[model samples]
Every structure is written in structure tokens, then in C-alpha cells.
Target chain A: MPALPLDEAGKYVAGAYVVFVVLLAVYVAIMAAKLQRIERELRELARFAEQRNGERERERVTTDV
Target chain B: MYGKGLRTLSIATVAALAAALSLIFFYAPLDADQGFIQKIFYLHVPLSIVALLGFVAGGVYAILHLRSGERRWDAYSYVCIHLSVIFAVGVLITGSIWAKASWGHWWVWDEPTLVSFLIVFLLYATYYPFRYAIEDPERQARYASVFAVTAGAFVPLNFLAVRLAESLVHPRVFATTAGGLPGSMMLAFLVSIAAMALLWVTLVKLELTAKSASGQLKRLRRALDAPAPGAPSRVAPEV
Candidate 1:
């Protein structure tokens, strides 16, 4: 049943495999973006907390002085 | 063990998946009999097998969590089952395409591939609503564990039943798939299987990481929201 560019059957078969690979790539990209965002947020939170603690310590030292 | 090891494991899994997929497309020979269409079988079969494996892994861990009262085990189990369902849906679609190409029909009622996978999809469908219905988190996990274990048991039984049915009804035309595959093709199958397994692990880790991060973020935000006398950024919740 030879027909057209790659044979209808063959094209469909190849397409099936292609669909999976494409879906996988999309999934990885989503995960990567998510991971980056989460890490960035966590870092921001860490810095904020550290700065707050430092300010609190400074105030305590000033009162003692 | 798996709780803290996710990061390194995710990288290694991605590498393994890449290697396995390379072997699938590059090293595997074209089938002498089924031609290009048989190639789909390489992916479809492995994905189906791995989906079953995913459910079973979830079931096993669910049992552990229920017995030991470990939240980590419950989380792992839920993630496993969830990803497996997604992957299984992929397999079902691709397999239907393959079957249509080979048999001149979109689906076959008696096809072992069609029947068994249908059973699994239905079984997994029930899992979500069942999980959502329960109010107590641990108790919900406990019931879900039981259902997942039951589904895990049925998956193999359905597979076996389909095989037996094929033998009795369509003995000549529906012989086992193993007879058709050659050595190179077999290698491809094995590689595909490995790749799918690695992909499953990688995907699960990524999802779990996202969930854990969000959970931690929620806690951090709550703590930040509390009236810390020196904190400056309590104006609004972090977007």
C-alpha cells in the first residue's frame, strides 16, 4: 500500500512515536520552569528572613549600648 | 530513602531516558514483517508495561504508609499512581492508532490491548473521585491505598485473561506478540522499556519536587505574614 510521502501507514506509525517524544519534551520544559520559579521564590524568602533577623539583632545591640 | 534523594535521582533518570530513547530510534532495526508500523509497538508495549508497574508501585507504597503511618510513603504512592494514569492514557491513544493501522479498525472489543487497558483506565478514573470524597487526609490515603492495591492486582489478572481469551477465540491470527519480534527488535523493546521507566521516575520526581516546594512556600508565607516586628515585606502575599 505505497502512497505519497512516507506511506499513510508508516506516517501514522511514526506520528504515534513522535507524539510521545513531543509530549515528553513539553513536560520537561514545564517542570524546569516550575523548578526555577520555586527556587527563586525560596531564595527571596530566605533573604527576606535573614534581613529581618539581622535587623532584630541590631536593635537588641543598640538598646544594650 | 527516596525522600531526600530526589534531586540527583532526577538528573540521572533524565540521562538514562535520553540514552534509552537514542537506542530505540537509532539502534533498532526495521521490522521485517510489520514494516514501519511495528515501530509503534516498541513504545506502546513498554508504556503499557510501565504504567502497570507504576500502579503496582503506588499500591505497594500505599500499603506501607497505611501500616506505618508515614506521610512520605503516602505522598510517593499517590504520585506514582497519578503519573501512571497519565502515561497509561498516552499508551491507550497510541495503541489505538497502531491497532487501527494493522487491523483496519480504530478499536477491537476483543483485542487484548484494548480490553485490558480499558479496564485500567476505568479503574484509575475511580481513584480520583474516591480520593476527593474523603475529608480526613490520612484516612483518605488509607482508603486510596486499598483501592490502588486492588487495581494493581486486577491489572495483571486482566492481562492474563485477555491472553487466554485470545488463545481460545483467535488462536491462529492472534498468537502472542513475542513470536513476531526479532533480536534487534527485541533490543529496541528492552531499551524503550528502560527509557519509559526512567521517564516515569524523572517525571514523578519533578512533580513531587514542585508539590513539596509549593507546600514549603505556603508555610514560609504564613510565617512571613505573622507579625514579625522587624519584617518589612508583610504588605501582601508573595505573588
Candidate 2:
């Protein structure tokens, strides 16, 4: 096939590159969301551990006193 | 462990990709046949190659999963397939754009390579539903591994069939090193392939790390007897 004129060909070339970049960006965004969820879960788990530790300490002090 | 070299991988990927783009635009000569539009070749072909290989890798991991009965291998297979599916979408879309630019149509029925690739993509597309359909985790992983291996085996056969179908008439400009291309074009092509491969590895590692984190979170919750956070993932096997 004969190549399209430079002006016309530019659009398709641009479109192809844009599609590639956009897809990569979308994948990165999805991963970012997953990372955010992981952070939240870690925070929740940390808080849960801290609460349990506090409760155990309180029980121990009460028994001693 | 998955994130161990992620930073270095990311840096190397960026460096390679930047070098590729520069070489593509500045170093590579305009094609006598396709001109600037041929630039798309650098992006499209590499992605196609990487995605195809990823499917095969997924199948390899699946085989390991089946042999060892290790859920981690299953997780690896799943992530590889998942990433490849995403890349496949880019392949089809970019390929369609290239086709439209070259042939004046968004799709062409007569092109064996294009058709074969589409077939491969369609075959892998069924993976999600297939996994979703089976409720048993162990059974699902086993069956999915089998499917991956079967599909992976089909890839090379499909390529061979396509080559045989149009070997003489349609010369493959896509395979840069196969003899026709100029040295500059070949260099850009190789660099692009390297970048795309690195990008694939980086993304796969990122995903596996994410899954590992999620799995650890689940383990923590179980240990603490903390009420389960939201519904568990139905399709994705936790590592």
C-alpha cells in the first residue's frame, strides 16, 4: 500500500501512540487504586492490633491492683 | 519480595523507553514505503510481541502450578494472563489504527496475521468467565491452568498457520531483523522491544506485589479474628 500523505498520516500515527499511552496510564491508575486499598487495609489492621494490646494491658493492670 | 527490585526496574524501564522514543523519532530514517506512519510499527509490534510472550509465560506458570499444586504459582499465572489481556486490548486497538492508516479500513478479513492475532485474543478473553464459572478454588485453578497451557500451545501453531497462509505474498516488515530493514530501524525496533519487555516485567511485579500485600492483609485479619473486611475477591486467588 502506498503511504498516506504526511499530513494525513500524522493523525493516525498520533492516534496509535495516544492509544498506547492511554492504555498504560489506565493500567497505572488501576494499580494506584489497588495500592490505596492496601494502605487502608494496613491501617485498619494496625488499629485492630493496637486496640487489642490496650485491652490486654488494662486487664493485666486490673488483676494486679 | 516481589517489590524487591521494583524501583530499579522502573528506572530502567523509563530509561529504555525514553531512549526508544528518541531513537524512533530522531535516529531512525523514514521508511521508503510507509513514511512517518511506520513509526507506529515501533510501538505496535513490540507490544504485540510482549503480550504474546506473556500469554506463553502465563501458561508456563500454570504448568508449574498444576505440577506443584502451589497456589502461588496459580497467582503468578493469573497475574500474567491478566496483564497480557490488558496488553491485548492495546494491541487490537493500535493494530486497528495501523490497519486503517495502511489499508483504509479499520479491519481487514484477508490479513492472516491480524486475523490470527484476533483469534488468539478472543480465545484468551474467555479466561475470565471460565474462572468465574467454577466455584471451587482448587478446581478452578487446576482447570484454568489447563486452559492456559492449551491456549499457550495454540499460539505457536496459530503463528505457523498464519505464516503458511500468506508467507510468500505478504512480506513481514514487522520482523525487523529478518533481513530487509535498515540498521537504524532495526536498532529502534530492538530498543522498543526491550522497553516494552521491561514495562511488562515492571507491571507484572507491581501487580504481584499488590496481590502479596492483599494476601498478607487477609492473613492479619484472620489472625486477629478481626471481622473480615469487605467481601473476598471471587476470581483472584490470594497468594
Candidate 3:
């Protein structure tokens, strides 16, 4: 194959690099989504714990009365 | 603990990647024959090599998992294969681009190197579905490890077969008779490989950390008798 002119070859080279970067970006996006789900679940768990603690405290006050 | 040093590793990967890109574009001399188009080699070859190594590493972890009957090793094996498959996708796309630029075709079936790589990629691609097919967690993990070890062993044999095959289209840089890569090109290639390997390790650590956190959360839920939010994953082994 004949050597491609610099101007023409540049596009293909750029395209290859672009594809690599795009794949990395997509992977990052997926990871970010997973992290978000984890955070949401943690928040729910914390709220549940707080709710349970409040119920226990209310029961103690009624027994003292 | 899985996340320990993750920050340092991430910083190091970014630095190495920057150095590699600088060397590839500015330092490495252009190929006399392929010229600028050959730049893709630094990216494509390193990704392919690292991905192949990752598969092998996954197999090693699988062996450890089987011997110790530990779930952590299975998690490691899963992440290694997971990242490798992602890297494999990058390899195929970049390889196709390079092929088109050099040979005027996106794919050439006659080339053993290309076909063998595709075969390896396809084989690893089935891991997820094959793993999910088994309903029992213990059985699933055990069977997946066996699959990983078998596929991992096949990788090297496949590579060796391609190396021995006579091929006119693909360039063989490692052949001693071919005079190999020039010094500058070799330097760039080595650094690129290091960068990719570091990146792979960093991603694996990150994934394992996330899985660990999830596992801990499940433990907490069980201890507190909190209702589970959703069904557990059938494929991803608990860390």
C-alpha cells in the first residue's frame, strides 16, 4: 500500500484515538451510574434506621407514663 | 481497604497516560512505510496485549478462588474479565480503524492475527450469559471459574498459532528477522503498555471496592432485619 498523504492519514489516526476516548468515557458513565445507585440505597437504609430508633424512643416514653 | 491507595493509583495512571500520549505524538518518529497511520499501533497493540494479559490474570485468580473456596478471589476474577472485555472492544474498534487506513478494508478474514483475536474476544464475551445461566450461586461461581481457567489457557495457544501462521497483511514487530521496532518506537510502545496496565489495575481496584461496599451493605441489612430493596444479582458473586 502506498503511504497516505499526511492530511488524509491524520483523519484515520484521529478517529482511532477518538474511539478509544469514547469507550473510556462510556465506562466512566456506567461506573458513575452504579455509584449513584449505591448512594441511593445507603440513604434509604439510614432513613430506616432513624425511623426505628424513633419508634423505640416513643415506646419507652409511653411505658414511663 | 479495597479503596486504599486508589487515589494514588488513579493519579499515577493519569500521569503515565499523559506521558505516553506525549511520546506517541511528539517523540516517536513516524513510520517510513505506514507514516502517520501507524500511530494507531501504539493504542491498538497495547490495548490488545493488556486485555490478553488481564484474561490470563483472571484465570489465575480463578484458580485461587477454587483452591481457597474464597469469594474474594472470584470477585477479582470477575472484575479482571469484565475490564478485559471492555478493553477488547476498544481493541477491535481501533484495530478496524487501523486496518481501514492501511489496507483499505475494515476487516480482512484472511489474516490469522485478526481472526484469532476475534475468536478470543467472542469466547470471553459469552462469560456473562454462561455465568447467569446457572441459578445456584455456589455452582455458578464454581462453574465460571472453570470456564475462566479453560478460556484463559486457550488465549496463549491461540496467540502462538497466529504467530506461527504465515501472514502478509499484518506486521510482526517481535520477529527478530524483521529488525523489530525502532528504538524510539519501542520506547513509546513500552510506555503505552505500562499506562494501559496501570489503568487496568486502577479500574479493577475501583470495581472491587464498589463490590465490597455493596456486600457490606447487604450484611448490614441482614443484621438489622431491614427489608431488602431488590433481588440479588445472580451473576456477580458477593465479595
Per-residue alpha-carbon lDDT of candidate 2 for residues B109-224, written as tens digits (9 for 90 to 100): 87788888999999999999999899999999999999999998998888779866844433485554556878899899999999999999999999999999988888888889
lDDT string for model 3 (B1-239, tens) is 89999999999999999999999999999999999999999999999999999999999999999999898898899999999999999999999999999999999999999999999999999999999999988888999999999999999999989888878579876766856998999999999999999999999998898889888888888888899888665557778
lDDT of 2 by residue, A1-65 (tens): 79899999999989999998999999999999999999998998899899999999999999999
**Where does model 1 exceed 4 Å of error?**
A1-6, B1-27, B167-180, B216-239
Give the share of true interchain contacts found in each model: 0.48, 0.90, 0.76
TM-score of the candidate numbered 2? Answer: 0.96
Which structure among the candidates has the greatest TM-score? 3
Cα deviation of B138, candidate 1, in Å: 2.0
Model 3: fraction of native contacts: 0.76
- Model 1 residue B82 distance off true place after TM-score fit, in angstroms: 1.5
| lDDT string, candidate 1, B117-235, tens digits | 88888889888888878867767878888887888788778877776663342212224555645677677777778878887987887687677776677678688863322234211
lDDT of each: 0.73, 0.90, 0.93
lDDT of 1 by residue, A1-65 (tens): 22223387667777787778776777779878867876877777788888889999999999999
* Every model's TM-score: 0.79, 0.96, 0.97
* Model 2 chain B lDDT-worst window of ten: B166-175
DockQ of each: 0.44, 0.85, 0.83
lDDT of 1 at B218: 65
